[model samples]
Target: MKVRNDAYLKAFGENLKQLMAKSNKNAETVAALGGIETKQVYRVINGEHSATLSIVYAIAKGLEVHPKELFDFTFQE
Candidate 1:
């Protein structure tokens, strides 16, 4: 089944993509750095899955940024 991409997830994914671009990183690199599967990174980036708090922390760690920055995007929900 195709997963629904909520506004929040979409916004988060966009923010992640932007950060990845800025840092010259990709899903594989982020996954390695975050200690997650590359597919997991893609799923989050594609808005196909909602990451857990731990995953968010891992992603932030991978990006070398504060977790709050990942959720800095404006969203209605």
Candidate 2:
């Protein structure tokens, strides 16, 4: 079944992609750090699959950022 919160996954994927680019890291490296497969990283980056809490935490730890930061998007007043 598809995830109900697809937008969250999409946003998270975009943020992860940006973070990876900023860190000059590739999918293989990130996946290794996260203990996940490169194909899983590709799926997350492509927004074709949803990330579990464990994966999210791993990514946050790998990126050296708080997991909450991944969901922090401000709106203009």
Candidate 3:
């Protein structure tokens, strides 16, 4: 369970990073648009913590992308 959770977080984090890069918005701008703190953005992007679905949606919305984009992770066993 722990291993799966770790893998999930890593993949989610990577997805967030890619979206942010594609967004062309700096962390602070994205956080402000998402109505979250910059630190929270870093936390999610750095894989220091997992985010709730609400948070994921907010981030995707801020990035001007579909929420599904955030969940487009590679499958793992």
lDDT of 1 by residue, 1-77 (tens): 22334877888999999999998998888889999888888888988789999999888888888999899888665
| Segments in model 1 whose C-alpha atoms lie over 4 Å from true places | 1-5
Could you give candidate 2's per-residue lDDT for residues 19-61 as a string of tens digits? 8888888888887887877888888878787878887777776
TM-score of each: 0.88, 0.73, 0.88
Find the 10 residues in a row with the least total lDDT in model 2: 68-77
lDDT of 3 by residue, 22-65 (tens): 87887788788888888887888887889988888778778888
lDDT assessment of candidate 1 = 0.86
Q: CA lDDT, every prediction?
A: 0.86, 0.75, 0.83
The lDDT-based order of candidates, best leading, equals 1, 3, 2
Alpha-carbon deviation at 36 in model 2, angstroms: 1.1
